[model samples]
Target: MKRKKVQFGVMLHGPGGHMNAWRSADVPSDASTNFEHYLSVTKRAEAAGFSFVFVADGLYINEKSIPHFLSRFEPLTILAALAPMTSRIGLVGTISTSYSEPFTVARQLASIDKMSGGRAGWNVVTSPLEGSADNFSKDKHPEHSLRYDIAEEHLEVVQGLWDSWEDDAFVRDAGNNQYFDKDKMHELNYEGDFFQVKGPLNIDRSNQGQPIIFQAGASKKGSGFAAKHADAVFTNGGTLKQAKDAYKDMKQKAVEAGRNGDDIKIFPVLSPIVGKTREAVRERYKEIQNLVTVEEALAYLGRYFDHHDFSQYDLDAPFPELGDIGKNSFQSTTDEIKRRAKEDDLTLREVALQETTRETPFMGTYEEVAETIITWIDEGAADGFVLTPHVLGELYDDFLNEVIPILVEKGYYDTAYETDTLRGELGLKFKENRYTQKIRV
Candidate 1:
């Protein structure tokens, strides 16, 4: 039997996860738009038997987008292209339900599922960005509660569309003069508070039935929505204790919603910077930090605090007091900024220019890093991890080469791919067809 292991995935948001990594010379400045460079990274991840690859997206961008957000490939299109280049590894991409038609979005995701042979996953995002409404011909974005409401219906419609045809719906039989089983087909004549969709989808279910659904929600409504629907939840936890509480809360909420808690995976987001020794880790960490100026870092804060411009405040002063913000923006991140500020008694400058050192969570020698990751899994703080690297090329290679081996030896990581489907690899069940009832009738 394959060893029971801790699941892991690589999160590629632009060139890398760290905003300042784009300024680092080790990363090619145009890596965001460079497909060949991205292909190499994907190949490396696949070669190393990593569980999945993810791409985050946004529809709107302004001056604060840094480099990667300013320009990059659209998530679905790029994921489809990567399909032919690899096998077995999962391909997940982000799409905002708030900005898309369920039918069209369903079609696109179903196509990727077909292309990747059951290795497709969708990160269902509800909000687009700060000014995404104007691009969609609306003067204002939907409020927080309203967007979640739309998202709830949006998921229902999309999954219903995916269920348009049953698993055995298609049959090519020349002798009987038949092409498809009519009785096996289903029509989703669905009308919800937010949308009305009439869908007998144009595509069949891919290898895994439908693409696996992923969510990255930490707010009240967002968390509930994920517990009820998502196969997995991506999150942030600065410490082992925080991760354990988060993991328990999500599982409990899932159980409360009448679902088995194990069906949902909790992947805490971590960006590990490892070294042979603590000194080596801090030195390399400083190099990436020095690349971005204080002014640039403050501008970076604008993405989270959508309601307030931190640049207008005194840098040396305590992180400026702000009212409830990001209700229509990144609510969880905004809450985190406030929480960290109060906890650390930090200045606006310190908050903006956050850096990793020995005292930080995921920065340390190989042994220390491995110990913390294993503890999170054992302590029920995390089911697995969605790792974001500071720099995609060198730093990613370092973790794969150095840190993962340690995890495997300690019995917390797997040495090879145990399953072909993304759902199987992530230990999630295939989504049951909702339209199965319609077809039976």
Candidate 2:
């Protein structure tokens, strides 16, 4: 049999972009709070034959340190609103296991899936930021290991609740005054390490059974959890080799957990800054760079560096010699910068600019970008990509107009969405996957 074509999605962020994405004058700065902006983007994505539009969630903002768009509408609420506006596009949103109750999360997601006619997806995340704990009324954030532990159990409860309502559970016979079939509804009766969720979900099972589970942690515990549960894994891979290795590792882990390795769709976040020519792309990149301030960059860096003050260092300085500052503090960030700097033969200022810009690895003309994406997919580095636009409307419009047709022509992506439900579009086995295997056995 011939292999199936790859898939793709747009990873939407608040206020039109990520980090310094707003610096693009073409992006709407007010998008974080504006429902109309989200509607416009989702409609465009759907029209472009994109797989889905993903929304990331963060509860609090470090106002003094970073200019993040934190006070926007909640992910679930926003997704629900967008569901009514568009019919076929998937709506995936982040919900942290650290703070939310499984029942609440399960119910809300199920409701959205139903309301949207089964186009909802839940991106499960155990928030890494310690500051989020404060907003949730906790004195301190749990350690990383502990958070994953809770996440494992939290996922079990949520999945169980979703399964509580079987396909035939809702009959709604008006003549008999019967709304549901009691025998088909199963009480979850789940008692786990972190939570005790009892009985069936209040809502009926969604069109896709349970909404697709999206996960994005690359830590050991995270990978393990994703292997066991995630329908799609969102990742950040800087190189084709790195992405391939990560995808291989994730599939191996999934097999060990007794799930089909191919079931886990790997999507790496690709931030592409495209233009008609290389110089035009470079110029556009430079224009965004000019908007970044030293203070803003340092504030963004401070979150990972813990004890260090980036403001004290020269803006154009190379890697600082931190003598025994503890490898735990920003080690990954520092190492990545060092590696990229050497690989690209970049100056310290260039490295700084790259960090602030957070451009997608694939940056060039439409044809070049399309070829690069196809190369990654062919290499088994990704099943698809989660595109993060550097500029909001313009960036998306450019890619949709320029790159999408190329992908469709190359037989790498869909010319049109094949299914209405988000889960169906992603090719996920909605009803008979690993979650139902245990019962079948």
Highest TM-score against the true fold, candidate: 1
lDDT of all predictions, in order shown?
0.83, 0.78
lDDT score of model 2? 0.78
Estimate TM-scores for all models.
0.96, 0.91
Candidate 1 — which residues are off by over 4 angstroms? Answer: 1-4, 355-359, 435-441
- Candidate 2 lDDT tens digits, 1-441: 444576777866755554655545666676677788788888888888778899987665656433446457788888988888888888999999999999999899988999999888889988766667888889987877788899999988888888886677678899999998776777878877789878677887777878999998776777888999999999877878889999999999999999999889999888788889999999978776677776776666555554246667766756555553423433445555656767766654555556767666688999999999888887889988887775676768898889988888888777587877877888887764333456679
Candidate 1: worst-modelled 10 consecutive residues by lDDT? 353-362
Per-residue lDDT for 106-173 in model 1, tens only? 99999988988889999999873668898898779888888889999999999989989988788978
**Candidate 2: regions farther than 4 A off:** 1-4, 65-68, 306-308, 321-351, 358-360, 432-441
What is the Cα-based TM-score of model 1? 0.96
